[model samples]
Target: MTFEVFMQQLANGISIGSLYALLAIGYTMVYGILRLINFAHGDIFMMSAYFMVFGMVTFGLPWYVSAAIVIVAAVALGVLIEKAAYKSLRDAPRMSIMISAIGVSFLLENLATYLFTGVPKGFPDIDILTRAISFGNVSLSVATVVTPVVTIILLFVVLFITNKTKIGMAMRAVSKDFETARLMGININRVISTTFVIGSALAAVGAILWGSKYPSVIPLMGVMPGLKCFIAAVLGGIGNTTGAVLGGFILGMSEIMLVSFLPSLTGYRDAIAFIILIIVLIVKPTGLLGEKVTDKV
Candidate 1:
């Protein structure tokens, strides 16, 4: 491939990677705190896309305004899901809680299908966002350049909040041991809700960026990204926040470069994740930066 073509492919990979990073953060954070898979998280991402469309078409809002509204609604929905479904299973066995999460995923997917129809909807075109800029011989989408910067900034902000604040400490305690944290005066519900909100907000950002890049919305839209990001979280070490972002970039670029360099591999892109997942499981289950974890007897 030519230098320009390679650069363009790299650019595409970075933009896609940034989206994966954003989505992976949500999955990682939720798992870190609750040890729950949150199968519904992907569908929540899908719902946010529809929410954006609804805000734009039904309420006649500007792109930015509609995007914000959709994010807020998604955040609220995430909290509600935790309260209505996950909360009840907090004291139950891990398997039961995970099953409930899976159920919620199905419920949301079917509900979205019923409400919006299984047909895909096109995202509204915003001229500025779609416009591409040229730098020397390299062509780049404005969204492509902007997406990673935004994602990095958000990652730092989240890291700061989780590392330097009181609530962050409480969240850590809860993640370590919910019952002990509760006994130590941390309000379980409040911390859990905050975790859900933050995770959901990140998912919304991913949804918006993904919708912008792909320009299509559907009930199952989040499935692939969600699953990929989930794998990324695992690859980076499930409970490690920073690892998730790094893993996301790796997965995103790998997928893109695979298709770019090996055009014949286009049809096997999804399988690549499964293969990587299996390799990671066998080779370095703790991930690149993951620490060895042990269960107390």
Candidate 2:
């Protein structure tokens, strides 16, 4: 490929990777605190897209207003899911929580299909977002250039919250040792709920950018991206936020470069994350930046 083509693909990879990173952050934050994979997280992402569709197309709201509604709705849904599906089972066995997560995921998917009729909806176009920018030889979509910048800004915001704020301190305490954090007078439930809210909001942002990029919304739309983002989280060290971002960029770049170099493998692009997940699990289970934690007997 030519240099311009390579640059264009690189931009595409970063844009896509930024979305993965956003979703992976949610996964990592939830896992860090609850040790739950939250299989339904992707469904929440899907729901946010629908929420946007409803807000904009059904209600005739502007894109910004619809986006705000979607973010708020996603936060509420995340908290609700945690309270309804996860709270009661918090003391249950790990397997039980995992099953609940899976059930929740399936429920959301089926419910969406039933309500939306399984027909894909065309995402409304926003000229400002969908417009392409040309810089010399490299041409890129507005979202492509904007997504990574937004992801980085949000990453910093999250880091600040986790490291500089009181709630962040509480979160760190909870993640480090849940029982000890409770003993020290931390509201376990609040910390966990806050984590979900933040994660879900990020997912909402991701869904918006994703819709802008792909322009189609379906009930099952989130499944692949969710799984791939989960893989990104795993590759970065499941509980590590910075690692999650790094892994996302790596996965995105790798996938793009793979398709560019091996055009025949284009059809197998989705498989790339799975293969990476397997390789990471076999080679370094703790992930690139993940710390190895030993369970007490």
Candidate 3:
């Protein structure tokens, strides 16, 4: 491809990558604290879109108002899921928690299907997001340009919260030793709930941007992105926030470039994530930036 085309594709990749990074951060944070895969995370992402639809179409609310409500609802739903599904299983076997997570995912999917039906809904158009801006030979959507910038800003905010804040310190303590932290006076439930709230809010942001780009909402919408973001999390070092961002960019660029350079493989776009996951597992299971941890006997 020519330089201009390459640049355009690169921009597209970065835009999509930003969304992946946002979603991956949530996965990494939950794993960092709970060591739970949270299979329902993607379902939460999917639910955000439906929330937006209801806020806008069903309730006839303004865009900004609808978005704010969706985000709050996402946070509340995430906390509820944690409380209802995962909390009781905390002392149970890891397998039980995993099964519960998967069950929650399916339950949300089926619930959404029943409420919204299996048919897809078109994401409402926002004028600013749909508009295109040109930079000499290359042109891009407003959402494409805004997404990466927003992602970067949010990344720094998250890093600051995790590294510099008091709660962040508690989170670190819990991640290192849950029992020790609990004994030391840290409120374990509060920290976990905060993590879920942040992660779900990020998912809401991603859902908005994703709907802007793809312009479709469905019950199963989060499955592909959810799985891909999980792979991105693993690729970046499962519990490392920074690594999740890096993995997201790399995965996004690779997928975009693949389709751009070879149109024939466009159909296999989803397969790319699995292929990368396998490669990452075989070559560097700890991930590019993930540290190797040895379990104590």
Candidate 4:
């Protein structure tokens, strides 16, 4: 491939990787706190996309307005899921919470189908994000260039928040030992709620960026992305946010480069994430940057 072609592909990889990174952060955060996968997280993303569509297309709102609305809706939905489904199950077995998460996922999917009729909706075209632009020899859309930048900025923001803030300290303490943190006067519920709020908001942002690139919305739209992001989280260390971001970039780059180098493997792109997951599990279960955490026996 030519240099320009390589650059284009790199841009594509970064854009998709950024979205994966955003979603993967959500997975890692929740898992770090509760050790639950939050299977419904993907559906929350899908629902956010629909909220965008309705806000922009149905209500004649602007893109920024729609996006704000989507974020608020996603945050609300995430907190609701935590309260209605997860909070009550706090004292229950791990398997029970997992089951609840799965049920919530199904409920969101079905509810979206009932409301949106499963007909794929076109994502509104925002000229600013979708407009074509040139960078030296690289020609791409604004979103392509913006995505990685956004991801990097957000990464720093999240890292700073988790590393510098008081709530972040509480989160770290809780992740290490829930009961101990509570004994230290950390409100477990508040920290968990904050995690969900941040995670779901990130999901909304990812969904908006996804719309810019893919430009189609459907009830099942989030399923594959959700699964892959989860895999990305696992590949990076499920409870480590930075690792999740790193894993996302790796998966995104690998998938795109695979298609670029081996056309025959293009159809097998999705399989790559799973293969990486398997390799990570076998080679390093704690993930590349993951710390080993042992339960007190």
Candidate 5:
């Protein structure tokens, strides 16, 4: 590929990577605290898209207003799902929580299909972000140029919240010793809910940027992306936030560049993520940055 071509592909990779990173953080955060993979996270992201369509098209709201409302709605949905499905199962076996997560995923999928009739809705064109722009030889959409920047800013904000704030301290304490944190007066439920709130909000932002780039809204749209982001979380160390981001960028870059370099392999883009996941599991099951956990007998 020529320099310009490579630059374009790189830019595209970064945009895609940032979206994966946002979603992957959700997986990492939940796993860090609960030791459970939230299979419903991607569905939550999917719901955010429908939320956007309803707010923007049905309600006839402005783009900014609709975006804000959708983010809030997504957060509420996350908390509700956690409380309704996972809360009671907190003390249950790990398998029980995992099964509930899967169940929630399917429920959202079918619920969306039943409500929306499996039609692919057009994501309303938010002119400011969706408009195409020319950056020298490589032309791209405004969202393409803006996604990574926004993701980086948000990542820093999340990092600060988790590392420096009181809630962050509570989260860390809970992750280290859940029983002890509760004993020390940390509200376990509150910390978990806050984690969900942050995760869901990031998913909302990711969905908006993703919709702007892909512009398709369907009940099952989140399946592939969601799974890929999970792979990214695992690849980087499922419980580590920064590791998740690193894995996302690497996954996105590799997938994009692989296809760009060898067009014939375009069909294997999805497989690439799985292959990486398999290698990571075999080589370092705890993930690159994940600590080995020893469960009590």
Candidate 6:
């Protein structure tokens, strides 16, 4: 490939990597707090994309306007889903809660398929995102630059919330010990809802950008990216936000490089993530930056 082609691919990888990072943060954050994989998270991302499409097609709104709506809707959905499905089983066995999450995920996906049908939908055109910026031999799409910028901003905001704010302190406390934190006067319900809100909001941003880049929307659009982001979360060490982003970038670059350098392996792209995941599980179960946990009886 030529220099320009290489630059474009790199740009593509970074853009997609940032989206993966955003989605991974949601997975890691929820797992950090509850040790539950919100299986519906992928569909939540898909719903957010659908919301953006609805905003444009139904209300004739601009992309940014729809984005704000998507963020709000995603947060609300996250909190509501937790209340309706997971709350009842919070005190149950971990396996039960995980199964409930899986059920919730399947429910949402089937509902989406029923409502939206099996056909794919195209993302509405937003001229601004299509524009390109060139610097020397390097060229970048507006969405490409926007993706990383948005991810950085949201990542910083998440970090600030988890580190500096009072709610952040509560989140950290709850993640460490829910009953203990509750005994100390922390509102577990509120904190959990807030955590879901933040995670879902990030998902909304990621879904919007992912849709814009791919310009395709389907009921199942989030499946692949969601799984990949999950890999990213685990790769960097689940519950570690910084690690999630690092892993996302690495995964993105590696996948792009694999396709670019070894054309024969393009068909195995999806399997690459799982292969890495299995390798990590076998060699380093705690992940690259994950902490090893020991239960005390």
Runs of candidate 6 exceeding 4 Å displacement: none
What are the lDDT scores of the predictions, listed in order?
A: 0.88, 0.94, 0.94, 0.93, 0.94, 0.88
Residue pairs with clashing backbones, model 5: none
Q: Which parts of model 5 are misplaced by more than 4 Å?
A: none
Per-residue lDDT over 89-180 for candidate 6, one digit per residue giving the tens place of the 0 to 100 score: 88888889999988888888889999989788887777788688887988777889899888988889999999999999999998888778
TM-scores of all candidate predictions against the true structure: 0.97, 0.99, 0.98, 0.98, 0.98, 0.96
lDDT of 5 by residue, 1-297 (tens): 898899999999999998999999999999999999999999999999999999889999999999999899999999999999999999999999999999999999999999997989999899999888887898888998999899889889989998999999999999888888899999999999999999999999999999999988999999999999999999999989988998888899989999999999999999999999999999999888888977754
RMSD of each: 1.2, 0.8, 1.0, 1.0, 0.9, 1.3
Clashes of 4: 0
Better of 1 and 4 by lDDT: 4
Q: Candidate 2, which ten residues in sequence have the lowest lDDT sum?
A: 288-297
Candidate 4: where is the Cα deviation over 4 Å? none
Candidate 6: residue pairs that collide: none
Instruction: Assess candidate 1 and give its lDDT.
Output: 0.88
Assess the local accuracy of residue 160 in candidate 1 as a C-alpha lDDT between 0 and 100: 90
- Candidates 1 and 5 compared: the better one by lDDT is 5
Model 3 Cα lDDT, one tens digit per residue, 153-225: 9999999999999999999999888888999999999999999999999999899889889999999999899
Model 1: lDDT of residue 150: 89
